[model samples]
Target: MAASVGRGAPAAGPEAGGALWAEVWALLPGTEEGLTLALSGEVDDCVRPLLRRARGLLYGAEGRPGEEAAAAALRRLGDVLRDYSWEKLNAGPWREISKAWRQVYTYGCLFGALAEVAAGRPLAPAVRLCDMGLLMGASVLDNVLARLVRVLQQHLPREQRRGAAGLAAESVRTEPRPAPAVRPEDALPRLRCPSLEHFRDNYLIPQKPVVLEGIMDHWPCMRKWSVDYFCQVAGCRTVPVELGTRYTDEEWSQKLMTVGDFISQYIVNENSMGYLAQHQLFDQIPELKEDISIPDYCCLGEGEEEHITINAWFGPEGTISPLHQDPQQNFLAQVFGRKYIRLYSPQDSENLYPHESQILHNTSQVDVEDPDLVKFPNFRKAAFQSCILMPGQVLFIPVKYWHYVRSLDVSFSVSFWWS
Candidate 1:
């Protein structure tokens, strides 16, 4: 009966088991020091016995512990595992919990391997348990850890949680020992609503980037598209949010949330940068489409004018769009904020070091602001034009021209794309 009980208990459903595993896994450590710290009373006492047994099983102990004690400890752990929800497990500092869990799983694997050697058995089932634990630990880090951190930041008081800016500051790479030399260049020219013939002859024909003023002054969005206005109009509408300071990082990802929640969490409160980028939000909210006009510049392209694609770009200050080129001519209209934009002509594509992958072919691998010039030495030769685009202005970006944009302040911009 004791053996049967030890071998089996009412198993939690997959969803519940996964949540429990994530919670426990989050409590483990990833390094030797973290493992030692976690085992030194950071985790629940009930978990200590199982961890001990895991160690013994892995290290080839003479025998299992007394049946009653082992069974009782197992029962206790099982109860906690089955009863706790993600909410309960995630109530504390998730980074600490995740580190602890990784440590526990690492030690558990070591213990399992040693026990297999000591027992002189064909294979011990406990080793499989250790393997599962290791996988769970990895899953916690790879999948849900960032989301958990975000949630913790949102709920906890400022003093309790490390600010997201501190985390971002840590990632800023120091300049290379000897910075690569780069040539200086002139700013992109600004023109005030030049005649369509002048625009076609001087800019479009030459395939040069230029900032056009007085183009967006007539758009309703220039006056009416404040954060509060968006919340009132599209608060409940769900939208895909880019969750990172920039898309260049591997840690960047996307999530879906109501526009109102996005405004409150990221725009108003100034949490970590969240972007409504490259999304055809106007298609989903036609009422919003009525507020802006596609610039006549798009019609200058060879493609049918009626087939223009519009994408919304809305984010807080410090948001960055890493150097990238589009397949179509782009008219980026600044509706309510200022943006620092740099443009590199397509002729410099060889120096840009575009990513090899087809999916990211349009995106440059090197960060424009702080390029690793040693690794991408040719980038030093890439001359560029730049401008600070203000509200009620439009920047005409010829198709395939490399552009990197950074918002100087809370900004909303729209891009009209055409062949």
Candidate 2:
């Protein structure tokens, strides 16, 4: 019977939908037997009657036959599952059983619709089941059912298939573009442990970007902070992660995840860029706070010495901070890896094309690396300094100095902001 049913069904095409149905059959118990066992008395008592009623509705054997019955059955099943507190059940932890029950309900509803479609019923019934499944948080089920629906659509005529294909294409999403690259015209000066007065006089006073080397040598983080060390120390702590390669992109968003998952997904593997930028990580994980000290250059600013705000910037290679300026003096210390930085002096703000919007006033609209000369012709005149900040080095960026930063490798940077 199973072989005959399989042979009678139309091919689902070469794409994911065909394979998805195969996986659905494998994951859902009793589905391979054409749901005969589930519809009969062979399965457990709790779900057996529901499955029977669902099958009856799909096959037009119950209540006002066709799509209406299928829709009603789906709603009833959804309501039953929603109100049945699985957590209170005698089964193990709800989390442990949630996946299995979700799979069961999803496959039960979808397979009923599939049976109807195979019997020459309309495809709208199946689509409704899948859509309602999604609304019920049956993501795994909805994903498979959606693929199955596409596979079924292959049986439709060319015009109908085109419309279905258009709808499916509209549902698919695209990944965001990678961060912009850096192209520096002039190089930044490199200083080796300059005296406080020299740093204040040359770089701080002039509002220039300079790489101050050998400043982070005393910090324990330079030696002890590694992927494994972070996992052991701060793995469980929850932190906000910036999702895209650049925050300036429209698709960019933030999510909260454990530090361990962030490292494994973004650092150890090149899945997607995740950044812990501009976060007060030290305040949350005080143990990590003990590894580093504030740089002396921060004192050169006019603000009170104790009031300086420290932010941690940690991310994998290709993460970018678009050309933007902060209101306070910044001493960015590179602790783990190298980074490419470009800075435009405050005097050249007119050439930088700062965004007109109030919130983005500090950010430049022109892509510094690939400036659209036709639109922003004056951008060509923007004088900027650039440098590659290495471990144990600090770059003092005076207040309102437009700067763009990109990590060259897996990196961790700490910044001190003072007025």
Candidate 3:
């Protein structure tokens, strides 16, 4: 949107200034009262000089500052502009205007303060002036953001709030049907395949989760990854903290002690969930070995793709795995420890209450062990599959099947998935 006000020109008259102020104020809602306050009596006098300076910067005619000085000024201006708004800084309708201001008027709000501070000039007014500038700038940006959101909403459909195209189409294509109840005894019978080709052709493509018993016996790390040996080899390179928090990324490289601390502190604790995307620990694992062939007992669907993710756990107490479904079939294998899992079928969508957006919400309404049905009325009717996974046991999770996992002991698991 173009500005209604003139650039770097003295207000033609109070009438002209009032017209411009009114035009700007009209962009925002619920601010008529504040606009009125701003226009009463001497308001133009207060806003004129700042507006002139801002206009000068906007036209690419202002003097430049050092890079560090410019960055500090921009950041300070951003903070000041965001503080007066109820929303996050630089979000919504006024984003473009706010961004433009940041670029052009990099040090407009702090030039005097910077000069005074550097020269030890002790200019008391400069401090107050800078603070006031920041507050007013925030107010201006807030109004702009509000307008931007309104404009966007006017042109877009509600479903476009967060792209629901793929998820919606998939849901429609698969008519809701009840899945067969999976029993604990049924878990052991399906642990192996006759050949890798057969497994890939049958199960992997279908996106089913399976548990395989004794597969770890083939892995070199099955014996070497034990907790005691890990503790001995890894000294005090990095200290461990509670789950759901971040730790030093350089710990393992800096000192071998960090690796043991990571396992003991993270793997053994129940109620721990480390966000895989945040720490980037998945990058540290070595690539799949060429000698290791895909197992037959495992299943894959035709023309499907696979994704592998590993999570390390070490707690005797189990972590809370919130109820969620994966897009692809999931195979969860316990490598060195044990965990208890509860599963729910996709047919239970109404009860699970999937998020409206394509991005899933990281929260669940029902608590697995002791659900408060009053809070989640549909939870009592939800169906589930349950099992305990030990080293070498793998569980096959069908596509869109909801499940919650809890570590029963210090354990490690790798999830292989395919679509």
Listed in order, each prediction's TM-score against the native is: 0.56, 0.56, 0.44
Q: Number of clashing pairs, model 1?
A: 21
lDDT of 3 by residue, 1-419 (tens): 22112222212234323443233224533321222212112322433344344333222233434323332332344344323322322455554444334322223333333323222222233333333333323324333422322232222333332122212222211122232244755343355533566555565555444555566567655656544433432221122223442222222121211343344334433243432221112222222222132443433444323334333343333444567776756667666656668777677778866545554553355666778878778887887667777677767777778887765544556665554
Better of 2 and 3 by lDDT: 2
How many Å off is the CA of 175 in candidate 3?
46
Please give the RMSD to the true structure for each candidate, in Å: 17.4, 17.6, 19.7
Q: List candidate 3 segments past 4 Å from native.
A: 1-189, 194-209, 232-257, 263-316, 355-359
- Evaluated at residue 268, the lDDT of candidate 3 is 37
**Angstrom error at residue 353, model 1:** 1.2
When sorted by TM-score, best at the front, the candidate numbers are 1, 2, 3
Tens-digit lDDT string for candidate 2 (207-295): 77788888889899989886556665555445678999988789999886656567767776666788987445665556677898988
The Cα RMSD of model 3 versus the native structure comes to: 19.7
Q: What lDDT does the true structure give each of the candidates?
A: 0.61, 0.64, 0.42
Off by over 4 Å in 1: 1-185
